[model samples]
Target chain A: MRVGLVGAGVMGRVHAAGWAAAGAELVAVFSRDEDRARELAGQYGARVVGSYADLLREVDVVDICVPTHLHHDMALEAFSQRRHVVCEKPIALTEAEGREMIAAAERAGVRFFVAMVLRFFPQYRLARELVAQGRIGQVGVIRLKRVSYTPNKPGDNWYLDHARSGGMIVDLMVHDFDFACWLAGDVTRVYARAAGDRYALATLRFANGAMALVEGGWANPPGVFRTAIDVAGTKGVIEWSSDATATIRTFLRQPEGAAGEVGLPLSPLAEDPYTTQIKHAYEAIRTGAEFAVTPEDALRALRVALAAKESARTGRSVTLQGG
Target chain B: MTLRIGIMSAAHVHADGYAELLKQIPDVDFIGFSDEDAQRGQAFAGAHGVRWFRRHEDLLAQQPHGVIVCSENRGHMELVQMAAAAGAHVLCEKPIEVSRERAEAMRDACAARGVKFMTAFPMRFDPSVREVCARVRAGELGQILAVNGINHSENPSGHRAWFADPHLAGGGAVMDHTVHLADLLRWFFQAEVETVYAEVGNPFAQGTLSVDTAGLIQVTLSNGVFASIDCSWSRPAGYPRWGHLQMEIIGERGTLVLDAFAQALTVYAKGGARWPEWVQWGSDPNRAMIEHFLHCIRTGEEPEVTWRDGFEAMRVALAAYESSDQGTVVRLSP
Candidate 1:
């Protein structure tokens, strides 16, 4: 499959690697900053396009790897051109936008896949399967946490702005929100409290009578990243933590005068979740199989995240329609 | 003079452990126990080979120097009142009573009788917890930013059915699990909880149980510190140990992650065990707490964990329920 990637940012680079691992032909790359686009395109032997419109026309599938606020417009344009799209998590900034994106894809008769990559991670996927099989019996409570240093420094990044990135809850915790719903069911209610833009704690009541505590933070020390999930069921409990699963440890001294950028923790998996997600998308597109995360599923996850954000703002619990 | 300590009731699951710990304490005379339930009381007495007083008053009639009230949540006030009126110091199990009015009355009763009243918060005596508290107090971690506490356990209804009974236990996991962390937060930060927001549910026994089996509580302290507690009876019957308490404290300078019950050896037995068990070899916090209770009684000093501590923690737990019910933040009056 021919793929065109937009936005030569951190996620764009990651998605490029994913597409490469999936053996997709990275035909083009586009970014507002031409140098970054050229640098990324040069790595994958892909050409740099001057505009998003030019990039969309060049490939059968357009991967939207831009900032969250840009996802709706870019995906809509891609679907208008009858090109399949792979968008990053959250689908869109608002539920309305997500719904519109889904509708546009249906209207164009093309596939729309959202990278809710947690569903591709082996641990989360296995946990979901276990819960579905009743290995842990009826679901009861789930606790999930993802904490790391702020994506970029506070003043220098769009992620710090709630308007652009939806802050920590919408951008980071949304993964766990989707996972919780995937593991249990639809969330009926959301209650959340956030401290600044750094940390947030949300409690979701699922339609199946299960409760989940979803915590996300940008408050960890530099170079530290942690993620954990604990699910309690009627018959047993299943738990996993990033701290407990590390098979490699490195302690190297920093070079003099080097920029102290935060490092992402690598899992050292034979095939990372991003690659798995991209491969799944490729296979589904090829065979007309259902995408692991449908547009509607992405919208549901967004609704829960938006509700949590609203709850945090109002200091009240927000209830979803039809649970 | 040896400190004489009597057990008020054995209706609580901790009663057996407390009884054994009391017998092991030095210079303390353990004066048997009493229970309102005749069968349970007799069974406990027979198992421990101690005198069984059929009535709480009968136990108080022993005129012990101090009494440990290990009754069910609803029975705490009655037993404490009896012990206080009998001029004996009281070390009562957590959630002093089912309601604020009763808890306050119990406190007044003890205060009026000039007998010391201590809340049984064993985590305060836990060595690891103490070291962390000391470090935080010493400004080792700098100014506190946030805290995350987890107290998870198997549903107590498996062994003590009253724990799931709303009337007997006051509430479910929220009532049973929230106090230790509530008290500990106050002790660590020396701040009062100004607001509480919680989402509670009975996922474990949704159709059968009338009380909540799990709660996720968020609180804002007076010092501007925010914290969350995942308090639940979500563990299954086959879980290795009864439960665990863990905390993550975020401070300005650094962060501290504490697993209070992580000091355990993994044991895989050859019997019909389906899961590996965690055998804890750490210092017994209950023993330390009981020793502190005896020391306070002997020295005629006020207990470290006071009636106010228990009252405040219960207040937080009750506010959690109110917040869950109303779907809004419940603010406490300072």
Candidate 2:
């Protein structure tokens, strides 16, 4: 399948590599700067387009890699050309823009997916599978803390501006919010707090007693990368620590002890998730498979991120807005 | 029914705590102690009133029912394996085996042997921590969203020479202390660590520790709770050594911050040269731990602390180690 790329920035470069790894032929590339597009196009052996309209008219599937606010317009442009759409996370800056993109995709009879990469992460996907399998009994709660030192790279500073990136909630945490919904179901309310554009703490209440605590921060002291999950229930508990990707510790209630999980719980896919996601998008066009993580799921995640911001601002719980 | 116990080393400070616990129990007998540093072992055995053997094999040969592998951070696994192979249950000290691969192997070995293999994480014995666990599980705190852990000690861990070697202590304050906070967080909220971004370094151990004597770990748990822990050996010198530990648990209904090792009195005295007043506090966590381990062994019923309890603490140590290496949030293994 042939593909066209927009926005030759960090994510653009990543997706280009994924497209190549996934065996998607790059038909064309587009960026705000002609020279940038030409440079990427030359490297990838693909043609360069100066206008979004031209790129959409050329490629079968348009992958939107632009900044958050431009996503809806660009995806809408692709839909206008009858091209399927695969967009980066936080599908749009607002729910209305997300709605527009969803409507456009559905109206054009094209496939739409939001790049919620956690769906492909081994531990995350495995957690969903295990919870669904009732390995830990009933789903109880989820607590996520995602933080990193502020990125000092050139041009990446746009994330610090709330007008563009939606700060930590959208740029970093909406992924967790989406995962919470997927793992626990539709969120009902949110309680949250944020300090400037750097840090936020949000709590999501699902319709079930299962709940979630999500924290995202832009600034951190650099040293190590650490993430983990602890699932508890009526029968057993499962705890996975990132340091050992294959090991999951579990404890059954009556046994008086917990044991490390057996068998491989990590993903078998060797390539980056973007590679798999984009390939799935391409496959959907040819085979009509359901999109991996749909636009509505992305919109639902955005609702949580926005609600997190609102709850943090007012120091109260905000309801999750569904599409 | 009594549990026979042996010691593998004397390098860790908690060795003394273990010896004292054994002395407190009528059913627990100190089988023997093995240390590479013969003099140190002799001195330790003399102080604890136990026999000292020159080689680890001698201690394992005792065929004790259980062993406390309290050697240097690097020696945890070898000793635990020896004890487990000798048909004995094992209690390896926290900062369990430096790396996850080794820890998993050791855990597997114990599993295969059908012997109880535990990492020594005595703090789960704290009354307040247990209180938090019961209350949270019962929905007393409602839905837990955020948690903060503060661990401060006079003369951060780098005060010891061996602690400075990443080879010996596994990174620094983050590796040493995260286990306590992580394990507690796991038990308190019944959550797993989902992702962790950590900043680890030494601030004051200019001459001593290889790992940072001070560090911070901010983690996201599997249950979607935001958590932060500030850990350091930053307390003033010539003060109490037990350290100060506190936790703030946030839930849907209310927030609870408990000072698990809170000392009742604080003495502040003015300095002669326009300096801030010197303050002092005390704690009894060690004694609490001694009581719990003994009680668990005596009852033969489940104890307050369990094997999974130790793994939670060890997992945090691995998380901080990984986060410091990758410079991003690391997802824990499945």
Candidate 3:
């Protein structure tokens, strides 16, 4: 399959490698920054296109790796061209925009895939499998945490802007929000609180009478990232933490005149989740098998995240319709 | 004179550990224990080689200097009143009683008689917790930002059936586990909880029990530090230990993570063990707490963990239930 990549940012590079690992031909790269586009395209032996229109005409699939605010327009343009679209998460800035993209894909009879990659992470996959198999019986309470330093430095980054990135709750915690629904069911209501954009906690009540506590933070020191999940059910509980599962540690000596540094802990696996997620999308599209995460799942996750954001703003609980 | 100590009841599971500690304390005269359940009381008395009074009054008649109230949640007030009237200082089990009114009455009963009332919050005496508390108070972490706490245990219904009885225990995991973290947060920040929001569930014992077995509680303190407590009876029957208490405190300058019960020797038995057992070799907080109580009695000083601490913590737990029931944040009255 010929694939076109958009936005040569961090996610763009990650998706480029993912498509390569999934055995897809990367035909073109498009970004407003010509240098970044050419650099990423050169790594994959692909050409850099001047505009989105040219990139769309050259490939059957368009992979969008831009900021969340740009996802709606780019994916809509791809769907209009009858190309399958892969977009980074938070599907769009708002639920209405997300729905419009989903409706556009339906009208064009093309596939739309959102990268909710937590489902492809081995630990979360196994946890969901266990729950689906009734190994833990009926789901009860789920506690999920993701904490890290800010995605980019303080200034000159769109990620630090709530308008562009939707802050920490929508941009980061939406993964857990999606996973919670996948493991349990739909969220009935969300009550959330935040300490600026650095830290936030959300409580969700599920339709099955289950509950989830989802916490997200961009407050850790640099080079620090941690995630944890604990699911309790009638029969048992499943718990996993990134800190506890580390298989490697390095304490390399710094240069003579350099300041001390913090090293990220490594938990290496055979295949990374990004590649696994992209490969799954590729195979499902090829074999007519269902994608693990559908557009509606992404939309539902965005809706819950938006509700949590609203709840945090107003200091009140937000209830979803038909939850 | 050696401090005289009696146990009011053996209904709580912690009573076993407390009774063992009492026997080990060198300066205390371990009088005996009372229990309303004749069979359970006799079994405990026989196992420990101590006397069992069938009635609380019979035990109080011994005129002990202090008593540990370890009755069911609802029975705490009556036991505390009886012990206080007997002119004995009281170390009451947590959630002092079920409601705010009853807890206040218990405290008043003890205060009116000039006897001390100490809450059973052994985590206050835990060495690791003490170190973290000291460092936090010393401003080593700068201004505290947030805290995440977990206090998990196997369902107590397996050993003490009343824990699942709503009327007897007041609530389930929210009542049982939330108070420790609540008390600890209040102690750490030196602030009262301003609001509480909790999502409680009964998935663990849905068919067999009527009470909730899991709860995720969010608390905002008066100091503007928000905390999350994943307090539940979530450990399975095959889990290695009773449970654990862990806290991650985030601060502006630094962060501290404390695994209060991580000091243990993992033993993987060869005889078809279902799970590897964690045999703790660390200092016993129970013993330290009892020693502290005895010291307070001897010195005529206030207990570090006072009735107010327990009362405030119980208020948070009660608010957790209210928040869960009403599906909103429950603001605590200042």
- On DockQ, the leading prediction is 3
Winner on DockQ between 1 and 3 is 3
lDDT-based ranking, best first? 3, 1, 2
What DockQ does every candidate get?
0.61, 0.01, 0.63
- TM per candidate: 0.96, 0.51, 0.96
Docking outcome class, model 3: medium
- Local error of candidate 3 at A176, Å? 0.9
Error of 2 at A70 (Å): 0.3
Flag regions of model 1 displaced more than 4 Å: A153-156, A251-265, B272-274
Residue range A95-187, candidate 3, lDDT tens digits: 999999999999998888999988888899999999999998988888898877666532247877888889889988899999999988899
Please give the TM-score of chain B in predicted model 1.
Answer: 0.98
Best by lDDT: 3
The 10-residue segment with the lowest total lDDT in model 2 chain A: A256-265
| Cα lDDT of model 2 by residue, B110-178, tens digit | 778877665576667666677777887898766666676667554434334666678887767676677
Worst 10 residues of 3 chain B by lDDT: B270-279
For B215-327, candidate 3 gives per-residue lDDT tens digits of 98999999999898988888888788888899988877645789998999988987643468888999999888998899888999999999999999999999999998998
- Angstrom error at residue A147, model 2: 1.9
For model 1, state the Cα shift of residue A292 in Å.
0.5
Query: For residues A250-281, what per-residue lDDT tens digits would candidate 1 score against the true structure?
Result: 68886643323333445888998888899999
